[model samples]
Target: MSGTVLVTSRSFGSGGLDLERRISDAGFHVVRAGAAHELDELGPVLGDAVGWIAGTGPVTERHLSLAPHLRVVARYGVGYDKVDVDAAARRGIVVTNTPGANTSAVAEHTVALLLAALRGIPAADRRVRRGDWSAWYTREVSALTVGVVGLGRIGRSVIDRLAGFGPRVLGADPWVPADDPLFDRLERSDADAFATECDVVTLHAPGGQTVVDERWLAASDRPVLLVNTARADLIDEAAVAAALRRGRVLAYAADTLATENHGEGASPLLADDLADRVIVTPHLAAQTREGVDGMGGMATENLLAVLSGEPPVNPVPVP
Candidate 1:
């Protein structure tokens, strides 16, 4: 418990160097390496390490077998789909994530994408650059009803921001209590029901292909606006593109896509017809300076807590 803590980072920017420094200053030896190579290298030092701050590396049972001294794993962000939690739990390793650390940053970015899609910001910018400055306003946020798919930390924050914009907010999360003050009204119905009732549907759920295929889009009553800043697999990209082409969806702004980490090089939703109607951003909802610093600090704190033989601030359940 008094030795080095291996930190496997996956293509983190130079800001990660500062996080390494903070870990070192906290009186623990740090072993920093890129995730691509670290999975192979972890076997060598796993016996000496007390904790690990993992990025998007594959922490399989094979890698876990080497870490007899490992106590906890602190993920850099909220998403833990990349890590094998069941394997870690079987070995008594506690996995933790920095949940609310990047809530405001991601929520703000989600709203920004929503507004950008609704107001045609990208198209308008391109038009202005092409020397066309005709005064035009298509749709307003106030004129639309927003359906929030998940009412978690980021979802609630987005709902709070949307409240100021005067848009009717409908939430669709069974995990949240019906009497919660965060939502104007909770829709116990499925995603299709929420999609049919709202003009704009924003996603804030964790990873998974929850809303798959064109059935959800086809079920909507109008050309809905889809905003996803959470995970790419929540919606079907091909189905969404088809909906956009058929005029069933007015626009879509996604910061994440199912093919993002698939190494496919191009998005399935980036078709020529859907390009102008879509706003696709890399998975950068938590890339703000403030969010980065907060995530780094919280990750370091979680690792340090495990090293000190205390419960982590955000421990991932052993299941």
Candidate 2:
């Protein structure tokens, strides 16, 4: 109960083990903050916290000003868009993130969504629930040409799973070398070519602003199914909505949305009319039991490493 560590990730102890014991065993008093995303309440608890494990919230310069003892900000997941890395480094605070920790969780969910969309699972379930016995069908999953936008950990995982389903999997990634040995099986295709050639396009690309817009999917030779589990910023929602309306993009399945919690109502794709066309999860793709525990352990280990005068296992790259 000497130095304080604040755990703001909501699912930190969701594995049902003694999460507090793990940190306390390392010689720090555990302080619980609701979730890093809830920044308003963070001000009251930041003053004494020497370490913090964050969730999907912004760790801004303004917030850091209040944490006089804060030594490290450990992001609970891979995405670091929410944290201000430059400012943290300026104050000599180490920033760390748990990457590849949720790979399986997200990859499994992405495939599940692909099946749901192609098989018309959600839409059909609604029809059956409302007492309609008539069966409706759309497309078969195994027959569709699939395109994967990123060939990284989660992206590669998705392709590996797709191989058993009997569809041709095309990979589109500018970051990876064309002759990289890692992509022995995945046929290489550029994003533009993949867009028109792929019947089902799934985005596992890295996070950034407007990576996919109307232009990306507009040239499709056929109606397409769009799946996104990486980050909402990767796709232009308004354009996707327009495509859904026009039937160029048949459906959209995603774990992450424009707003993680749609308290203000659904993002553009979550509209009532589009509910049948758009399937959105509450960002739980990586909320699986295994994913939660793995990410929590990684984030905690990073925090303890920084506090113990050791370099973090996975320090975020300085921008």
Stretches of model 1 off by over 4 angstroms after superposition:
1-4, 8-17, 35-50, 56-58, 62-69, 134-136, 183-189
Runs in model 2 with CA error above 4 Å?
261-265
Candidate 1 residue-wise lDDT, 89-141, digit = tens: 98889888988878999999999999899889898898899999976767878
Model 1, global lDDT = 0.78
Number of clashes in every candidate structure?
Answer: 0, 0
Per-residue accuracy of model 2 over 122-219 as CA lDDT, tens digit each: 99899999998787667766788999988889999998899898898898889999889756887898778876788988888877656568787577
| All candidates: TM-score | 0.87, 0.94
Clashing pairs in 1: none
- Residue 281 lDDT (model 1): 86
